[model samples]
Target: MHDFDWIYECAVIFYVVSLLGYFIDFLQNNRKANRFAFWLLSIVWVLQIIYFFVTLMQINRFPILTPYEGLYFVSWLIVTLSLLINWFSRIDFFVFFANIIGFIMMSVYVFSPETELLPFITETMTTELFFMHIAMAFLAYAAFTLAFVFSLMYFIQYEILKNKINFRRLGRFGSLPELEKMSLFFTMIGVPLLLISLIWGAIWGHLTLDTFFYFDAKVVTSIIVLMMYSFLLYMKIMKQEHGKKLALINIAAYLFLLINIFLSQSFSTFHWW
Candidate 1:
């Protein structure tokens, strides 16, 4: 097995550095802070990837059998994708909340000590199709999470403008249109991936649940989360909502997803996490 202790310890340190850099960027309004944060976050992701392969080799299976492992991997992927998007778009504002959430996720994994061995059922289901399904699902969730961060920033700045408050922090950001566009872009990509994930999940569930093809808690919660996004998408397409309202909807949807995901993981009888 890889040295879980060492890798996890390094991951925690890297997250802390990235978190600090992002926080500095938010407060000091320094573009370089974002650059530093992204680099650190990227390094940590690379290390985590190495650690994951080592873990799989040691256990002879994928490292997603536990909620901790699965969530950690998703968090890393979110950071990686955010970095890529920021590089191409040159929009650095979202790094603050992204790193903050990523740091919290890393903390959770660091604190929750667990083995990485796959359960028998997990091993049986780890086919190539299953891998694709889980990767898409997690990436979709990550995109939504990033969009939620942008939305929150948009709302905060929106409120400042509404109140006619002249805050220096708000001055650091680009125009509201700019931030809203980025948030909308992330949500658009995330919604389609979520739809695909739901369909693949249904197929996998049918394959696994031989007896009944009804609703489990995880499935029900996932569907509800999906519907929330669909509602936003519908509104956006109809041109009925824009700007702050759209951002608010994305924030609300992600919050609901977070609650549902955690609750099902905690109490469901058949949660894969």
Candidate 2:
């Protein structure tokens, strides 16, 4: 059990590092950073393989029969697919998103056992899940914040080019397309995380609230944020939009999200104290 924990912790560390590398590569088009991240993911893959066989030997059967085991296996599959994509193509964005899923799966698997091991822990698991919901929300916000920065950069770069001002240093940051796409990738990462966070938050509220109000400020603003970002994604995918339009939308969505975050702290009559 201790060994399993150690391996998972180490793998998670490497997974985070690899994700950071991929993120940097996606934003900068840095092939060297991409190569480093790829190798790190490979290491994580190898670690998971080792952990799988070790646990299999310990249990004397395949580990896929249980929910936690299923999570572990699914995480492994995601990593495998991500590595394959990185090896074969230019879809580092997919790898970034895929590994977010992988990291989440592994995180769930790691924390779940503690909840089962102790009686009090088991009882509090639902509450812990609620906390996870909040945590994921913040993570989504953080991803969106990055998107906002890149989008703002794109906006600035566009203005520079539009004015016909050749700022040589601007090129060091990234090209306009690269900045826009980086913003897109960051938003892509945030959207699902925010969705999942909202789902979990809704479930908790439904269970706990005596009377639910759709018009609550937190709820309304959160939904608005989600809808706005979702629309941004739709335009990118379906409308094939580009340039200042999408960047502006992203910036707008993030600004609203920030407003929601600070304002959501207020206690309405319906909310818990």
| Candidate of highest TM-score | 1
Q: Model 2 over residues 155-195: C-alpha lDDT tens digits?
A: 87799989999665455456788778878988999999999
Best by lDDT: 1
**lDDT per residue as tens, model 1, 1-273:** 245769867877887888788888877877788778878888888888877787778777776656687678777877787778667765566666676787777678777866544567766568776676777778888888888887888898899999999777675555788788877788888888988987887777667766533467777888888898888888888876888888888998998888876777675666657
Work out the TM-score per prediction: 0.89, 0.54
Q: Give the deviation of candidate 1 from the true structure as CA RMSD.
A: 2.3
Q: What is the C-alpha RMSD of each candidate to the true structure, in Å?
A: 2.3, 8.8
Q: What lDDT does each candidate get?
A: 0.77, 0.74
lDDT of 2: 0.74
